[model samples]
Target: MYQLAPNIELLFTEAGPDAADRVRAAAAAGFDAVEMWGTSDKDVASLAGALQETGVSLTSLLAEPRTNFTLPGTDLGPFFTGLDRAVENAGLLGCPRVVLGSGIGFPGAKRPQNLARLVEVFTEAVERTRGSGVRLVLEPVNTRVDHPGALLDRTADAVLVAREVGSDSFGLLYDLYHSITEGEDPAAELANAAGLVDYVQIADAPGRGEPGSGAIDWAERLSVLRASGYDGPIGLEYFPTTPSVESLAHIKAVARDA
Candidate 1:
């Protein structure tokens, strides 16, 4: 089974949901690794201290503050600034990967043109993070479900963007729930993703709930992951149906079944 990195940003809200509190809560919930989003806007000292105290490893975080990646007109200055800050924080947290949300599609532009702009910006982003020990993965969300009009919703598109970037520093975030929501076959997609995936995240489709709460076959999903030899952390980025500890029953079930 893949090591699970609980997304503290989406889980562990019972303990005040403060960044450090989430880290401590994830550890208390028996998770050894955790991922976060928007950690740059949080108290890094406290978060870093909590990780140190709990001995929890940081898995991944967002590359920049959430913004539209598909737009050619939007100024990338703030995005790049946020990326630099995130890289620095990743260094402090010992996080190896960061995720990028390929935002909603651009209005009044062809898809190729939008992708072209995205490639250009990410090219610069990859260069900017050179030697930072931090790598990037473009995260593809499902447009038909949770994210309408989201660009880069397909795993293939993210892989294509990473290929165009042509840098080892860039890769794809294969989120299973999103792919399933988008009506993708997870196993075939993972097989297609083969070499370009840097990270993985999971949630159940239809409601974005815990693994077993929806129609997703996590057993099959994990099987494909194992077959693909994906060594990266699999983030538990889902909404719990109950208390945080109670939410982990699925993880236990997965381990036992595996």
Candidate 2:
């Protein structure tokens, strides 16, 4: 079975105030792994200690400062600074992946032009993290619901950039919620994204909540991802209508079956 990693940032709030406490909460919820947004501002030492105490592996985190990737002549200094911190902190937590977003679309810029810049940025990032064992993943967020004007909302665009960048340390994150929210069928999209995805994130559509609360057939989704031969940890990055534990009841079984 593919390993499950709970997003402690959005899920597992029952664990309480401190992020380390949330790590413990995820462990208690029966997940052997946990993920977060960025570890830069958090207590990495304490979080590391909790992971050691609970034996939960840190799977992934966001590329800090949420660097945007759409403009041609935009300054990348701030983004790389944040990336450096993200790498150091992720190494401390023993995480191997960091998520990046394709900021907003550039005004008066062609898609190809922006994508070229995106590839260049990720290429440099890939070089920076080379030998550190950390992989950079570009994620596509939905525009209609959560993120309007988001440059790379389609999974295919992420696939394009990842392919153009062409590095083992860089790939796309196939987010099921965003795909469904965009009205694209996962079964069809997964076929094209089969080899390009470095990680998987899922929340149901409509409310971005638990699997059973929305319209996605997770069993079919997971089965399709499996057929794509993706065996990485699937991040359950969702909001729960009830307690986090209660939310997992439906998808946990689906994951087990997957």
Candidate 3:
């Protein structure tokens, strides 16, 4: 069996149910850790209580209230406020990671300017929680299907950004499905970015379901991750074409047998 953490985002039928119940259900189903989206579906305190009761750790959560991909140089007062609130909530839940996605890219804005803005925003975020022990993870989403306009689409680009910031508190989330769908060789890309990668999430391409549900060789890819020295928990941020429980079973099987 995989001796790592997993998020509960894949288990939800919708974002409509109680967050605590979702965490409890994931724990009951045998996940060591569970990550949640923003505080939209439910309150953070209730989710924290459920985690405490089940003894499951809140692995990660999203920084919310950011409507657009406002870079650092622009007006980011609102974005920083949301990030601070998210950091505080993450600290409360005892979660060590916070997945931070840059806002959508604006074609009108200059590339250099946007990159500079991102560095500023991330640097500020790192500075806010100097001793909190929470990592602000930047996720590069695939612009093909789900998120078509995300700022950081390439893993290499994420690594560059992380290197520019040069802080342990800031790192990359490295979603495999997005990287694969965007035509990146996960192994080579990850190898090139081994230093900046802090967390890794996985799902098959095309369908965004569990491993082995699509054409991707999940076992080979996972073995590559293991060989590459990434022992972090793989986040299951996928969409279930079928029911979630069935998909979860498939994911567990893949992890156990791979």
Candidate 4:
């Protein structure tokens, strides 16, 4: 069975706003792992304490104040600074990965040129976070629905960037929801991106809701994922149509069979 990490930002909000309490709620729900977006707004001390007390692992968190490498003359100092802070917080929370994004590309630049620039920026980002015991995973968000105009939308493109970056510390975050929303075939994409995906997240397509609430065949998809050789924790990053626990029933059962 694949270990599932529910995203606290979207799941378990029934526990209230304090992320620390959410950690507790996720634990009570029998989750041993959780993920979140940014840490800046959270009570780090309490969150860390909750994780320690509950023995729940933080799978990953976002690299904040995302830098748009495609934007000409964009200052990268803040991005690196934010990365450093993120690494520090990850250390505190025992998080293993930091998710990075290629913000909207420069309007006037060619796609190849923008992607090349990403290679340079992420190369340095890997170096900057070296020895932190934190792996960097670049995510390709869908532009069509959730993230309009996002520079990196295709899983193939993200795999290319991760390949170009050429660091063991850097890899790809294959979000099944985004890939499906962007109209790519999961089996084909996962096949091409095999061995490079360090993390995976999921939500049902057509509405980005919990698994059974949408059209995806979880058993088939999970089988394809396993076939791709990614035996890692899958982050449950979907919005629930019902209570969080109730929303998980389908995927949890499907995953167990998968």
Candidate maximizing lDDT: 4
RMSD to true structure for each model, in Å: 1.7, 1.6, 2.4, 1.2
In candidate 4, residue 118 scores what lDDT? 88
Tell me the whole-model lDDT of each prediction, alpha carbons only: 0.82, 0.85, 0.76, 0.91
lDDT digits (tens) for residues 162-258 of candidate 1: 8899998888989888898899987788888778888888888779988888877777778777778786678888988888778877865784444
How does each model score on TM-score?
0.94, 0.95, 0.91, 0.97
Quote the lDDT for 194 in model 4: 74
Clash counts per candidate, in order, are 0, 0, 2, 0
| Of 2 and 3, the candidate ranking higher by lDDT | 2
Q: Spell out the clash pairs found in candidate 4.
A: none
* Candidate 1 Cα RMSD after full superposition onto the native fold (Å): 1.7
Clashing residue pairs in candidate 2 are none
Model 1 ranges with Cα > 4 A deviation:
68-72, 256-258
Q: Which stretches of candidate 3 lie over 4 Å from their true place?
A: 1-6, 12-16, 66-73
Candidate 1 has its poorest 10 consecutive residues by lDDT at 64-73
Tens digit of lDDT per residue, candidate 4, span 100-180? 989987567788987888899999999888899999999999999988888999999998988999999999999999999
